[model samples]
Every structure is written in structure tokens, then in C-alpha cells.
Target: MAALTGLLFLGAMGTANAADGFQTSVPSAILVDYDTGSILFEKDADKRIAPATLAKVMMADVVFAQLRAGKIALDTPLVVSVNAWRRGGGPSGGAAMFAEVNKPAPVGELLAGALVVSGNDAAITLAEGLGGTESQFAQMMNAQAQAIGMTNSEFHNATGFADAGQVSSARDLATLAAHIIRTFPDYYPIFAKPNIEWNRIKQRNRNVMLDAGIGADGLQVGWLKDVGYHALVSAVQNGQRLVVATLSARSEKERVEETRKLLEWGFQSFRQRQIFAADKEVGRAQVFGGAQSSVGLAARGPVNLLTPRSGGERVSARVVYTGPLRAPVTKGAEVGRLEISRGPVKVLDVPLVTTEDVAVGSLMDRAIDGGLTLMGDSVRDLARRAMAKLHK
Candidate 1:
């Protein structure tokens, strides 16, 4: 049985198809489907690079978590610490909210400063207020990164100030952006605010996509002397939301152009096709010890795929399971996987679960089924060996 399952797994390792014709100057980039977590296009997406102000996204995430837990309210006042003042303030020579030292600001205004204007001081102030110190707040940032499965991220500060070990990946940033969008939707609107008034300084948002007439709503942008310009831009069109992350572009204009190209390609190049509805039978699996000889298998939710719009290639699907399955089987138990492919390229794979339970068969029925299972196993072994030889 184990060998048969291995063979089945090998058989299901589907082929790959290239998403060609799209290119970008950004060294690291990724475009993902917000609904399905599908990678439409990527370039060195996992390579860790300085996230610069993009780290504020995670900083905002930590603050949003506190807000959701009721530990702090939007109007909660936080005083600017000396560390926040000296490093992230006007003296730091970076973007700042120009917050006065020892002056208190509301959590809502601080968030606006940090997100809309990329204020390093507001980020540090929020960090210190929440975590007692910037160092401790960095610990919280790392812990949150782990919780959210940002495998290639590390944080040394909330302000995203250049540090020795501070780095993140485009893919990880996309995941973080998606998480923020899904988790704190009530607070997400602040990212789109064009500018915020704090300490009498009016700074416009650095995100150019908002002004480009694209469906872009809210997200973060990052830039550093050595790291160049990076942007995590998301847009919605016709109910479809897509997030694009770019790192190390030559200039702000170049980053914006590259990100826009990726978004346009993603929206214009692919069309979604619904393959299976929730709880709808996709196929059947043979059951050895159940009263019935076979059980229906279905998808837990609607299965959809984004396929090339040209429509020249045919899409195929197969249900792969280790069988004959022994009863009793419970409904909704994951029994197999559904693999969908366009031509030779596998596009989507989802679990195939039993739609109904199967009860144990009678003693005589079990005996008959047991003998048939042995015979079927022998045939499967031969077929597996034949297939292996053909591959060689």
C-alpha cells in the first residue's frame, strides 16, 4: 500500500508552463491573487532585501492587533520618547511626522502618520508605547512575522531604519499585505488617505498608484539609500484584488512603472474559470470494507483557476487517492487531491474529501472485499512497475 501511494504521488507531480512575455527591472517582485493565493508572476521573490519603510506595514499590523484586542483604542495617546525623537524625528534626515519631543499623539493620528506619510517618528512612538522600547517592539515584530508565516523576514526596528540584520522578501511582504487587508479591514482605509496633518506638517503619501486612476486603495512604500525604491501596491478591478510587491528598483518612477505593468498584465492576461462548486462531487473512490463499493468525493469550496486568456490550451483534471479505501469513512474526511492542469502545466491543486460516510460491511462482505483488495493490489503493483520502467 505504501509503495502504491508513493507511485501515485509521483504520477501526480504535474508539469510546468511558463508565464512568458512579462518583464520588470525590479530585482525582486511578486504578483499574487488575493482570493486564491496564486502566484501569477514572480522574480526572485524569496530573496531577502532591506524592506526600508515597508517594515511599517508590519508595525501597523502589530498596532492593529492591539487595537482589535481592545488593549488600546484609536484615540489612545502615546508620548514621543527621546529615542523616537532623535532617530526618527527631523534630525534623522529621513521622512518624519516632525513630532515634538515629549508631545503626545493619538493612536489614530500616529497610524496615519506612519502609513500615509511614512513617518519614522510616529512608527517608533507607536512601537515604544506598545512594547515599552524599540528593541522589545522588534521582538514583537519578529514574533508576529513568525505567526503569519513570513519565513524570510527579520526586524531590527519599527521605523525600518537601515540596520545590519533587517531584511524581508517580496513574497513575504505580499503575504503580510494580504494579511493586513483581511485582518484589519476597518483600519485599512487609512492607507488611502492622501495626507495627514500632524504637528502642522502636511506630507503627501508616497504611493503614486493612488493618483494614477488605478483601483489602488491603500498599502506601504519603502526606500533606502542602498536598497533603492520598493513598493507593495494592491488594486481591485471588477471585484478581483491583486497585490504587487517590488524591491530594489532604480528609481521611484521605475518602481511605479514596473508595478503598474505587472498589475496590468495580471488583470489583462488571465481569466478565472470555475472548475468545481463547493460540496459538488468531483469523482469517486473505491471502498473495500464499506457496505457500498465506492464513495463520492468533493471539493470543500468552489475550485477556480486563473488561466491564460488566449484559450488555446485545454485544461484537464484528475482525482488522485490511495485506494481502495477501507471503511468506515466519515463525511468531509480528506481522502485525496484534485489536480488541475492546463496542457502539461499544473495550475491548481485542492483536497478531495468524502461527501458521505461509509459504514463497515458484514463479515462475509468484508472477507470478499479483502480478497478483491489483494487482487487489485497485485494489478496496481504491476502497473506501477510498468510505469516506472517507461519513465526510465
Candidate 2:
């Protein structure tokens, strides 16, 4: 009876702590390490959810591709077509840059307006400029999504709005955001725009992190009654970058708080460690026929791992491979493997290879050695048999 009471008290305490740390309003969320792609915390991240304006990340991908290919420039002026303006103009769906039809806006200004103010008109202009139509631009978005290995996402339009079928999972959104951060680093600064200037008009960023008292620098946010609230927030601190994606948040305040809590937990709970330095000499392998009998080998992996930061010793390491390698070893030949473990968990299995070439011995030398070995073994066996017979 006493043990049962203690158990109940422990369970209650655990529940209380979880409640304190976790939010009550957000329906889905994910936090990840931007450098290593480690998921620190997640809740229903794979479940399909509405992307809302967060779909703009895919749109941005297409635009950045054009910039990288030198097909477009930030200062290039794009003419707004009637179709783009009409498609983007709506009530309470997405903010518009109020671009006039047939008028031109700088590519950079449109990008800023899309990111800072979540402008649908700016996105449509970009889509038309890059893909000739919003529908075709969506194809580019989906293709890029597949290219980046986003399995749980599909794009129906260039802008994430209240389309009946436009949707993406939180995990897919996080993957897309990570790709943007890694692939188009230069354009990433646009996400940090607290306010943007276009056609002599200024609009403030809808992302709450700009003033949410956190060190939020880049990313986007969205809200639609059907989709609730969503955001993809990214921040870098102390050289570590973390991306948090929240979906179906009840309110803007909840989205900001939930993002902060998730990021804080990730940075505070884990750390990056160098388990094996790249190309550092790890072991040696014997060469069958070579100038040297053996050559030094080193690990072939990054030699670093992200793990819990709570003061643990260096991982236990062991060499795993068929050693005493036979014959002429080519320099940099992969031969062995290094297995590293922290406690019972294996951190990494790194491939080890020869650091330098080893030439095989001459055929005459190999023949002579084989003959000597065979002769010595035969003589020893015969002598042992003869001695046994004499003793008998």
C-alpha cells in the first residue's frame, strides 16, 4: 500500500513537470538540429497538416534556383500581370504588396514583401516571373520538394492558402526549411526582415519572433482559420542553428512560446561532440606484398556526433574489420571500420582506410618465403613422428 502511494506521487510529479514544460495549445510541433538533422523533440510531426503561408518556403526555393542560375537578379524588375494580382487578391487570406497590374517591382522587394509580410501578391508575381504561371510554379515547388527528399509533402499552389487539397506534414515542412537554410544561404537573410519597403509602401513582418523577446532572426509564419496557426522559426546561437516548426497552434502567442520552449529544450539538453576526427589515424592494416608490412589507417567520417551534453566520458572505440590486409594496398583504400559506443548505444561506425599506398613484394621474394615456410613445417612434422616411433 505504501509503495503504491509513492508510485502515484511520482506519476503525479512527472505529469506536473511535463505540463510545465509543454504547451497546451499547439497541436503539432518539431525541433531539430540544423547542423546534423537530429530531431530533438517532436509531436505528431509526420501527420499531414495544413501548411498555410509556410508553403512560401517552397516558392522561395524556386525563386532562389533562378537567382543561383543567374536567370534572375534581386534588382531585376518584374511586371505584374492581371492574372497574378487577381489570383492573389482576396479577403483575409494572404497579405498583398498592392502591386498595380502591368507595373514592375524589383525582385528583391517582392521577395522581402513575401517573407516579411507574407504577401500573396508578391509570391504570385515571383511565381509568374519564374514559372510563367502559378500552376507551373507549383510543379517546380513539388519537384524541389522531391529532390530534397520531402516524402510527406505536395504542393498545389505557389502560395499556401485555403485550397481544399494543399497540405504538408510538419516533418516535411521542417525538411524543406532545413534545405533552404543549407542550399540558399544568401537569400536566407530575407526571412529576417522585420519590415520591408516596396513601391514606397512598408509592411511589417507577421512573424511574432521579431518581437517575441527571443533571438529570432529568420523564418516565416502563417494563420488561416481552417489551418489555425503555423510557423517555421529558425535561429542560430553560439554557432549552432536550430529550426522549429509548429502547426495548428491555437494563437500567435502559443506559436511563439511553443517555438521558444522547443528550441530551449534542444540547445540545453544536447551537445555536439567529436567522436572521431575526419581522416585522423585510427588503426593500421598489414599489407600482403608491400615495401612496408603495414600501413596506417584513419577514420573516414566527420568524427563528430550530437549527444546529450550532461558530462559523459569519450565513447568507447573498437576496430572492426578483416585486418592483416592481403597484397598491394592502394593509398586511401578503404579496409577497416571503427565502431564507437557511448554506454550501450553505438554512436558511429566509421570506415577506416589506408592513409598511403604500400607496394607488393616481388614475385621472387614471395616464392622464396613460401618455399622456406613449407620446408620448415615439413621437417618439423617428420622429426616429431620419427622421435615418437623411437620412443615407442
* Model 1: residues with Cα > 4 Å off, grouped in runs: 1-19, 281-297, 312-330, 333-354, 357-392
Give one digit per residue, the lDDT tens place, for model 1 in 1-392: 44122212222222213345567888999888788665677778889999999999999999999999999999999999898989998998888888999999999999998999899999999999999998899999999999998999999999888897999999899999999999999999999998888777788987788887668998987889888999998899899998989999999899889888888888887777566688988888877767666789888999776756765345567888888888999999998988765544454567889999999976755665665566775554444445446757
Q: Count steric clashes of candidate 1.
A: 0
**What local lDDT does model 2 show for residue 138?**
89
Mind giving the per-residue lDDT tens digits that candidate 2 earns over 190-243?
A: 998778766667778888776765566788889888678888988777788888
TM-score of each: 0.79, 0.70
Go through the candidates in order and give each one's C-alpha lDDT: 0.83, 0.71
Instruction: Report the error of model 1 at residue 386, Å.
Output: 25
Candidate 2 worst ten-residue window by lDDT: 1-10
